[model samples]
Target chain A: MTMFTVLEGVAAPLLRENVDTDTVIRIERLVSLEKVDLGHWAFETLRYRKDGSDNPDFVLNQPRYRGARILLAGRNFGCGSSREGAVHAILGMGIRCVIAPSFGDIFFSNCFQNGVLPIVLPQAEIDKLAEEARESAAGGAFAVDLEAQEIRTPGQRTVSFATDPNRRRALLQGLDPIATTLQRDGDIESFQQRDRQARPWIYG
Target chain B: MPGQSLFDKIWDAHVIADLGSGTSLLHIDRHIMHDLGGGRGLRRLSELGHKLRNPELIFATPDHAISTEPGRTSETTPLSSGYMKVLREETKKHGVRLFELGEDGQGIVHVVGPEMGISLPGVTLVCGDSHTCTHGAVGAMAWGIGSSELVHVLATQTMVQAKPKRMRVSFSGRMHDWVRSKDLILYLIGRLGAAAGSGSAVEYAGPAIRALSMEARLSLCNLSIEMGARFGMIAPDDTTFEYLAGRPFAPEGRMWDRAVSHWRTLPSDPDAVFDREESIEVDAIAPQITWGTSPQDVIAVDGIIPDPASAANPSRRHEMELAQRYMGIEPGRPIAGTPVDRVFIGSCTNSRIEDLRDAAAVARGRQVAKNVTAWVVPGSYIVKCQGEAEGLDAVFRAAGFEWREPGCSQCVAANGDVVPPGQRCVSTSNRNFAGRQGPGSRTHLASPAMAAAAAVAGAITDIRQLA
Candidate 1:
């Protein structure tokens, strides 16, 4: 995973509610394409026409929003499926941050694993940020400073955010979480020993 | 100490250690995986030089990407063949059991887990698919995990998770004649918005829930994820125990007695307090169906399509309008009598034997509409055999509905069986998302009986009317 700290770039406004994992990347694409190449197929149904041409109406396909690193979305974004490919697709598409009112529980967790910052903001704040992104589409760069725990819009507005301190530390240092958890093997082993004696049938 | 919820009891039992900030390292009692993520995660774990910590706790099957065609092999779906092959190889290499296709226990992971008695009361189960919550019906503390998390669970037999608040959704009153467990859940999601259950573990309780059969309970809990709840469960009762009794992986003799005693203590305490509570009256719930993209975009089969202008907010109105356009539905129009081109009667949600019996009852002595193509893909190979032994397959075949093999067919559209582009399908699947069945495919989620009615009528019809 790449270390996430200060990221500044254009933010695409995909403010539709319930933007599920299926929309982020279809299951067909996930099966056929490599993880790194998933960017091309991210939002394939919404981004491209049936004939494989870019759908001009999509926000991400617009010239100004191209290469966006931030995504301003609506409530419950990434709301369906536990497919981690959704985060891979978003990261592949160069989106390092997703700001929404809320998110699906599994998708929110998946984002941290892949170094994609899923920030939860009040809907009012998200609307403001989305408006600013739309108004200055040509050069509306949003800066997401994970270290500072704040987002700065092109309009010079700074909005603070909160994330789990442990998750924040992992993302900042790009540390593999499994390694950290494995260090507590002694604790895990002891617990298992007790549980096994208590419920032998559960232990296979 | 006050009282503990069912979730609280199960969660506390599984905590290996608390990592602060409400997160805990949870010992996974059961970890089920499917072809799509299982193979990739295993290969990744190997690349990282990690060995499986507890292969005995892990179960793998190739359901998501395997073909459901009759007499199919791993190569039946060329695109997914490599995934199936890799899953077979990885599971073999790691000593994890793989439920091979066409075998007795093979099915969708969620369906297979509970049927094989791997998902038990008071146990914590995790799978790489969102519908893993389906196993919670057996009174397990089950939820979905992502790819990286899969590798973590495989390497350590545990996972780091934040504790979710407890929520109790009690369904009171008897259901109407034509209504089913699918309708109860669909109605709940429609009444409460899609995100209502976010950040909580929901326990379905009350007389109506208790009255449901084990299969119906499974169908109801299957949609917990659709309502944004990662975990949904019911207290283990006679219905759950009877369902698990004599199953392949269940405990035997003295072990069974001990297991039952433990499960009896797994329900919420009498004085248990939840962070939130909700009550629903199910007597008036009709057969529910989605008319738009999201599962929450649903209405009664006899209800009219909602007008976007009446939406609660601007963004909501925009979403409704877009959904209407994509679904090719007109605002304020009655959803019933809307023509459908296909009917799919299978998925982890409703592919159990009871579900097939329900659909077969509707299809008996009837013919599928001329222009409609209907298929019944059983949940598991055992379910297929049972359905055949019960003569449900003959009813479906006589009614022009194709009887297919078991897999997650047409549900995710990765297995080559899909409703074509721009075609409308009345499906007994969990999701009705855009392009869920196929690109440009419009899905109306319904009960199996309702889907069968649609197949016969070639349109969305009230199941009550048919009855």
Candidate 2:
């Protein structure tokens, strides 16, 4: 859990919308995965062919954004399945954060849980950033400052975004949700005690 | 005080600690596990020196990576056997109840949960699989969680979650015989798009949902994940209680009476208002099928493949283009009679007994197409036994469809139950995502009967046109 402050790097343009968990990382990759290098298989079907050679046509396969640390995506990114492998693959590939018009609820929470920032902005702003990212692929990088709640384009334009203060704190402090849940162990114990008397059969 | 919707009441009851900012420590009544990522969580918990706080509250099964091939054991494949071993060893060491493959109660986690009454009214259930919402059919507030979240629940029997905004989707309809609950959900996804239900807790209400059998209700809630919502529910009523009565995990004696009394109060208050509302007035709905990669790219049985150029929204147009290219379908072509090479009549979405009966009806006395391969994989051993007792297995076998054991089968290609590359299939599974069935395997998501019809026709054919 590395503290996420300012992440500056090439932003891969996954312009397509509804980049589902299936597309983000195949179930096959997760099933046989060990040590979690699933990032290489992100969009495996689209990124590679049967011969195991890179497809070269996919945005991630192109050399310019090959190791991008950020992603500029379409609306409704990560829409299906609550597979955390989607976020794992993204961060595993060194993509520190994702900027989309919106994201699937579970995937959004997963990104925060894993300390990979998922920023939601309006389509107009996202479109601008995607364009800026493409133009800067040769040299400059797209920069995100969580503390400032802004994304600075390579062209020097700062686009502000909003994130929950609590999520922001977790990202800044690199705290996972499990760690957060453990903080209320006493309350959880109290609820269990009260519930046991109230509804005994719900327990095994 | 504001009147609460049925979802709000159920959600509020589960809150152990109000974490503020819309988040809370919610108690989990049940934690169902499947083989895909099942024991991985327990392994992590053990490594951290944390034992399962409540093993009795958790249940495990090997469905995702198990073989549905007839006479199959864990040794059907290296992948399936390895996954089965992982859960068997962990659940044994941790004392969690497991329905191992080839065992009596073994089945898909979603199916086994409801059939055994482990998922009941006024409960909070979580599973590592996305389709866990299928349990919400019994009026539970259920959703899918990731492995990390699964570990958290294993240690605490609770999860930290943000309360989702409540939405009521009222469906009132006069359904034609060919129209099933599957069509209703596919139609909704087509109209709403995949992202429409993304963050909402959707409650299906009104006449249409009320008329659905418990299995049909489960079928409807099962695809809530496909439309982008993790949570979907139906208010528990007489239908729910009746379905659960006397089942293995349901309450008995005086405790059953008390539970029923509490469940009756779970329905939304008469004055309750949801944060949002959606209504569908369906005089008649044709059997629906997806023609493209996304579940939302659906059309009526008689409709044509959509043209991306005709889309009004640019984003939708882009999506349409990609889907069409990936699915290998041409725009404006008729969807009906589109040739298929395989027919899959099973999955959490439509593998229940009620679903099997419909497919068997279509298959009665009809031979599968000469060039097509078809399979009927039941949802669970219980469902398989029940279907066999009713002789539904004969109906499928006589019609030339393979009668297989219950597991995920081709619904997910995890254990190698896959449609080959460049092949097309008519399946009852939830998703039709590219490479979902297998790389270059194009899938058309349909109802069981529709799949049966397709199996016989060797093409996508309407169930109404059969017999």
Local distance difference test, per candidate? Answer: 0.92, 0.87
Q: iRMS value of model 2?
A: 1.6
- The segments of candidate 2 whose C-alpha lies over 4 angstroms from its true place after superposition are A33-36, A137-139
> Which tens-of-lDDT digit does each residue in B1-467 have in candidate 1?
77999999999998998888999999999999898899889999999999889998888888888888888888886766888878888888989899887787798888889889899888999999999899999999999999999999989989999999899999999888879999999999998989988898999999999999999999999999999999999999999999999888888899999989989999999999999999999987989999999999989998999999998888889999999999999988899999999999999999999999999999999999999999999999889999999999999999999998888999999889888999999999999999999888999999999999999999999988998
Isolated chain A: TM-score per model?
Answer: 0.96, 0.91
Best by TM-score: 1
TM-score for each predicted model, relative to the true structure: 0.98, 0.98
* For model 1 chain B, the run of ten residues with the poorest summed lDDT: B76-85
- Please list all clashing residue pairs in model 1, or write none if there are none: none
Residues B111-228, model 2: lDDT tens digits? 9999998999989999988898898899999999887788888988898787887878899968887788999999988888888887788999999899889999999999998888
Docking class of 1: medium
Which 10 residues in a row give candidate 2 chain B its minimum summed lDDT? B99-108
